[model samples]
Target: MVTLTPLEAELLAVAGSVPDPELPVLTLQELGVLRAVHVRDTDSVEVELTPTYTGCPAVEAMSTDIERALRDHGVREVTVRTVLIPAWSTDDISAEGRRKLREFGIAPPRAQRTAGPVGITLGPTRTAGQDPEPVRCPNCGSADTELLSRFSSTACKALRRCLDCREPFDHFKEL
Candidate 1:
């Protein structure tokens, strides 16, 4: 096994310490945004990440946090790079991250289901009485919420209103 120098080790540890700007309770690593960390020449550190969604405003804040963390960890030069290919999916969310989201009153993503591999087939009919299960209210835990909007404060979530509690909450959209 290759041993990282003190500087490299420090960089890695500090980089993981940086929290997600939007969801402050969870660190970047927990959000699965901190993809890779590399240190070269003992002074420069490069970190790669992908945004939760396209054109997410939090990207700037994430980059700033990364730079700050590396600087504090003794990296004289830091480079924050974002990669878009392959994009991001809810499946990338860590187990700890889901717990944090749930504690924050946001439902985490559910397991993916498809009609078939490589494609989703629409059945000829979904009986009127067989509607998909309603999302549980984040505030009241009642399964009587209605989707208010497809988009919310973030692209990855939807705005929903609980019919039972009359409270609005963000539901992490299933990707």
Candidate 2:
């Protein structure tokens, strides 16, 4: 089993508890944004964060919150780094995060379909061989939903209306 130093463990505990500025209902750990925490030999903490999307404006706020959290926990030095090499996907959202999203009236992203090296295409016009998955309604747990708009309050979500419940909600779009 892997072992953690006292400082590393403390840093993780503090940083993981930091809540996402955009979605306050979930912690950074729940959103899978708090990727890793390291205790450097210089007696500083290094945190790795992955944004839900490339252009997410809340990343800065998140970083600030993380730093503040560490500082409050008696950590003198802290560094927050954003990593995009592997990129962040809707799948990164934890199961608890999904439950929170649904409870907040936002439909979570659907499971991605298996594809080859090229990956699946998404647009107004579906590829001849690609079949779009149905978007479920978070409010009533119904599959009878229709797209209202391609974009919602954020780029990562789409506006959708549930025909069964006649409720409009945001659908966390699959990355």
Winner by TM-score: 2
lDDT (CA) per prediction: 0.76, 0.80
**Model 2, global lDDT:** 0.80
TM-score of 1: 0.80
If candidate 1 were superposed on the true structure by all CA atoms, what would the RMSD be?
4.2
Best by lDDT: 2
Q: Could you report the Cα RMSD, in angstroms, for every candidate shown?
A: 4.2, 3.6
lDDT string, candidate 1, 34-108, tens digits:
777778666877888898888799999999989998887667898999988566777778899888887899967
| Cα lDDT of model 2 by residue, 12-96, tens digit | 8789888878778889988887777888855688998998888899999999999999989888888999998577777778899
lDDT of 2 at 33: 78
TM-score against truth, every candidate: 0.80, 0.85
- What candidate 1 gets wrong by more than 4 Å, as runs, is 1-10, 114-134
